[model samples]
Target chain A: MHFSPILLHIPDGFLSTIVSLISWAITIAILSVAVKRTEKLDEKQVPLMGIMAAFIFAAQMINFPVAGGTSGHLLGGVLAAILLGPWAGMLVMTAVIGVQGLLLQDGGLLVMGANILNMGLLTAAIGFGLYKVGDGRKRTLKLGLAGLGAWLSVMAGALTTSLQLWLSGTARLDIVLPAMLGVHAVIGIGETLITVSALAFIFRTRPDLLDPAEGPARGGRGWIFVGAAISLFVLILSPLASSNPDGLERVAGDLGFLAQGKDAPFSILPDYTLPFLGEGAFSTIAAGIIGALVVAILVFFIIQSLRTAKKNA
Target chain B: MHSNIFDRYLHNNSSIHRLAPQVKVVIAILFIFSNALLPDGDWLSFAISWAVILLLNWLARLNLGYTLKRSLIVLPFTLAAITALFSVPGKTLTIWQIGSLELILTDAGLIRFLSIIVRSWLSVQIAILLVATTKFPDLIHALEHLRLPKMLVTVIAFLYRYMSVLTDEVIRLMRARQARSAVLPGRNGGGSLLWRARTAGNMVGQLFLRSYERSDRIYHAMLSRGYSGHLRTLNQHELNINDWLIIALAFLLIAFLQLFAHSIG
Candidate 1:
């Protein structure tokens, strides 16, 4: 429901089915592990997780004017990760992304896995790791590092999205990769400022809101240096990146992805759904069920094998 | 701008509304998956999928105009796909030069772009229809039945319940800020951008504390009532014969269409 002018989610049909399915598998695997890690959710933590998710959701709606009369909203992945642990943060994000897709149609159901992996998994996992790098140091340093982590997290998500699109043959990596990384590099600055200032407020008002180990410190020189470096990088890169906006409109009038799809003889569906209906009344339906069962069993075995492999290692 | 335009579940007695929530979830996913898998430029398949979606909308007694408007949320994504026009290398149909930069239009690229747009538009429509018919909590329930993690489901359920409460709290906080300050921060006429942002950050911090306290109280209340970690809802999702038939028919429809498209190709 929070529609920021800056958008980067890869919608359905943009990625090939194979890429999307693989993303789904990876996402499910990570989330299931996350579920295991957080299995014994303290009775107190459940409501905290819910309310934090809601708070993040509500905070996203309150957009601030950035520059040139345009506005931006918080992604909250790093913020949630800093406030909560990384695993719980990922869960909060997963729920947020799921709700956005299912209720608001912000992203497609077919591509939810990819969306979650890009915006949720990458941002939290990498952002949190970078955040802890400055841990056991100054509080100002920690906040500055949080800002840097938030910024880099957005860039990482953009990079992953570009890679997926390139793999899907939607766009050439040379063109879209730079365009995406450049745009997100600018947007990540906004992410950084919001995250740092919010953390600063918690540092001032409710120090206990943050984890206890990150003690308050005095100097903010590290914060100033990091912030300046980010701005310098964006100022140098964004203007050179302006050509991409017109690239889409200028290149071709209109082309169909399925133009060549119709000429191809092979279809992946038949291999999955056998033509068993030729024999009996319900054979087609039976074949469909059998195919579904086969897929389920295949997935179960794969997961089992993975568990065993992990145990052995 | 915060409105209930999203939770637009209408009160109507229609077959689409009557279907179990899980069935609807399955149907929507299957429909989207099938549409995404459809061959690019396969106009026949696109038309059939659109027709089936429209028929469901009619069955649900939803306003066509509203549904269409809601589906336009996919436009920004379509803009992203437009990049494919320039980046996809193929046989050139037209060539142009912009500032010593060569740009070429390829038949294959254009078709790929259009197919992506069409497929995404269709998928959005199906998704919108699914949400419009079912209650939000019921959708979460369906996800639980589908074996999504219990903790994840519980988090989502609480989010749905508290989203409105927290939104109202934010509205109140903003109103207080506006009343105290001479100019509304961050708008057209306001204080410096950084000052306004700090104020907003403080507001967020305050909201988090308030929500945290409220959750503590809520948890205590639940404990007084012998609350456990798990939340239980009365079982109301009993699948019927019609549900099975609908599932079968939907799968068959998808299979038949894919098979038909293949044979013709």
Candidate 2:
């Protein structure tokens, strides 16, 4: 009857009906989108996806020695995201979580929705997002990012769990939140190393398995070129600029200006007017709108190109 | 591979087992929700709920001792809830100065902690009852009927079916590792921590490749037989008037008991 501390599966009565119901609503919304998208997958991927779910389940059974004589198992959100795409990976995690709750009694049935959201949807989404942080070509970079992604995914899950417990009045946020984060930060290191090693091994052996949904690596060069061009333009033309005196100054001072700076306060400039016209809230909004539009357009083209690339492949 | 750990489904011809899987799932959720919604420290409600759960267990023909033993799985969760005993601020019943910090236990905290434990125990008991009486696949079919995403259900079905196979594969891999390396008989028997981890990582990589290739072959085989994306099977669910009556009677009783407990408490 002893359960490992590393499991983090919330049992019943920990969450109120309101929290559980809201979680179920959000989980169902995401899962419905996942189902709709995956429905368009090739029929050949049917067995592959199923077997991948089994692989995750089996992988979890293998326990590795963590710090202090205790053992821990893989959550496999990042692994699934790397092997499959995020959508499919989320589905696989959902299935794994569901089966664990239903059969193994690892989690409570009432709280299954929250568990899935924390361990499945959020982890897969965040991990996949971090995995895509680096370019897909370099082996070392991909593996490194995968490790980071895996580590962050665990922390994110832990954070979400603590927040949910706090919201449910199960525990005080001041006590449980710090405790959960501190414990999970160390646990996340083990996750990172395991994920890195596994990904490196797979990349060395069969890189084809690493991003199945990404299809072939066509137009990547073109996309990089486009990205560089956009970056150059943004760097030169951006009005939000504050140069740091030195590395020491930047470290001692705020890092807020490292990205976009604070917008102007007043509405002297119209929203469409460039920042050069006036230094007001309207210009800041205009600048923000312009930046968002550019990014959206770029993402749209990248996706379109990837779809065509997949067709070619 | 320890497939025997599974097959918890008890073969019984009781009326509880005869109810549709969807009905049973709904009833289980309702029971858990009702138990959870009850006011903390309402021992009357808790007692009534336990009595009803025990009744259902009897109707299902499950062993009382086994059911009680199985319900002990909620113990770990109770430990987590126990933290509230010290952390929750209220009327201090006891306080101990340990080193630099003071650990205080309040009456309200104790009540909340105990309530959480009892509620969880009761909820898990109902869950165990549902899973113990219904077949696994039937339960999954019931989920499908409940409109869980198809992709999720499909993955669950395959994961459940192939988990044992993959576990067997893992056992073989471990056996191979053990045969090659022998050290002490206790923990960390065969290798250092990093070595064991590396071997595990390799095994995982190997398993992924194997499962991947197997999936490809399976897909090809299925395709040769005109396989498509959708999974179709014969529908065997049929609900009778007895099922409806049982479900309705159970809900009505639960409602009445809850209302009575609320009014009295």
Candidate 3:
């Protein structure tokens, strides 16, 4: 597998324009609602949310090598969902994933929905479920289990994405499953470790920051706004994501769809580079930096706007 | 800096943002669902799809250059996937070699490839426009109102909030490495495998540590507030008449699009 785990790039032109647009629309709409609700929460919490969203985007950049010939990126949905709440987690993941599609093009615009469903919905939901069991009096045990669940679900998202590709007939099961699952399994261990560590850190550092009993903690609908603001910045570093093909690519190669990969005409941005704009890794690095800058600026303003709203309210 | 993306996207600034997330979600779902089922070769249907998207894009006022630039990441994946069509053993339109296997561009292969491209471009553009127009926070708020599972919504919200925090930490580490002689002399980075691998590991460790601390702080706050798992809040989400109109319009459009696809097929 040639996949670089730090980045899970879902290529464009895989899904049609309609799919991409609809996904964008849906995500934006949902994110907006999330923001509005989050705005209504403890106003002070907004900045904190911004910083946390940045953390997720940052974590996504770290790649771990896998068992086979590939690697897997961190599917941090479980970690986020467990800490924030599943709904909040999903919205944040979608925002990050959305910016990846729009700004960095880490994932295809068309399949944005599928991408969100995989990384956002699955990881967060599963992580949340697992975290719930562990969040009891035995928080240490809860944290441990939550870590395991988070790791498994990240792989589950990868598996689900693989299945979606295979089901769509663009990929073969035998090759994709082994290629994806194999590498992801190894990657999953790292995810588990990271989740456990993160959980431990949170539990140990400021356990009171996340107690469910807090009034604003319960009614912090305003956090939704903060989370959405964070999503923009979450993708600031997507251009830095590993350019290697993911699990699906290996599977596609082994199972036969590998040959289908080809360049497109009328495509303004090809090869993930601006084309004719410097060569080699420099352009890629430059793009990543610029992309990150763009995302960061966008998010800053978004947060600012939300802050204004809170003040006005 | 590129506020142009959003400025142009939300040409309508009155109340579209206040609509429920579910309506938009349902509309997007219906559109994509029918799109997937549509015949691959239906030029008319494709045209209709294109028309709808283009119209939406235009209405959103997105800068074509920015939108396209942002959309570039889709290329490699699309090309890679379409490249597979060349080897499906169908009627050969063109044949060549890239590395080892003979890459064949068959008619069926070509159609599959083209569909994938179209799908990628169109879908991404629309999605981008959607985000450009609607604010992100409002979108999630809408989802909560729509009866989307609270836990799921909360998870997504957190991921959105914290993803960037950790990434910056990675960059700082990268910068620290750059400060230490770096790889490319003045550039502060190298192409060495060992260096890259070490950096990746260290970065991962740091990310885990930072995120761990943040989650802990948030958890304690939750507990301090008397949270027993159920994230309770009284924020009510309402779908206004405009929202209903949007949903109805979406249904009508999808219905027509599906009908058009079937007739053409």
lDDT of 1 by residue, B1-265 (tens): 4565447687888989988999999989998889877887788989998999999999999999989998888887665666577555578888766543455678777888888888888888998899889998999999988889888999999888888888888878878887876755666665556556556666777777888788888789879988788678886787899888999999999999888777775
**Prediction 1 TM-score vs. true:** 0.80
lDDT string for model 2 (A28-72, tens) is: 898887777777767666677889988887777666666677665
In model 2, residue pairs whose N, Cα or C atoms come closer than 3 Å (at least 3 residues apart or on different chains), thus clashing, are: none
Write one digit per residue (lDDT tens) for candidate 3, span A1-313. Answer: 1212432455544444454456556655765555565555653444345445556666665554443545435667877776667665666676567555533446654567777766776676566665555334565556555655655565566565555555455543333433454455456656665555555445544677557664433334343343333322222212212222344345545444442333322112343345667535566556545543443343344334333533675
iRMSD, per candidate, in listed order: 6.5, 8.0, 8.2
Error of 1 at A182 (Å): 1.7
lDDT of 1 by residue, A178-252 (tens): 567656756766676567667776776678777635322111234345334433333222222221223332333
Instruction: List candidate 1 stretches off by more than 4 Å.
Output: A212-313, B1-5, B89-91, B179-189
DockQ leader = 2
Q: In candidate 2, what are the lDDT values of residues B144-262, reduced to their tens digit?
A: 88877666777787887777787677778767876887666665564555555556666778888888888888788778888776566576676778778877987997788778878
TM-score of each: 0.80, 0.80, 0.56
Local accuracy of candidate 3 as per-residue lDDT tens digits, B95-212 = 7765433556778766766776666666666556556666555565665676755544554455544444455567677567658643555673444332343345445546555655
Task: Compute the DockQ of candidate 1.
Answer: 0.25
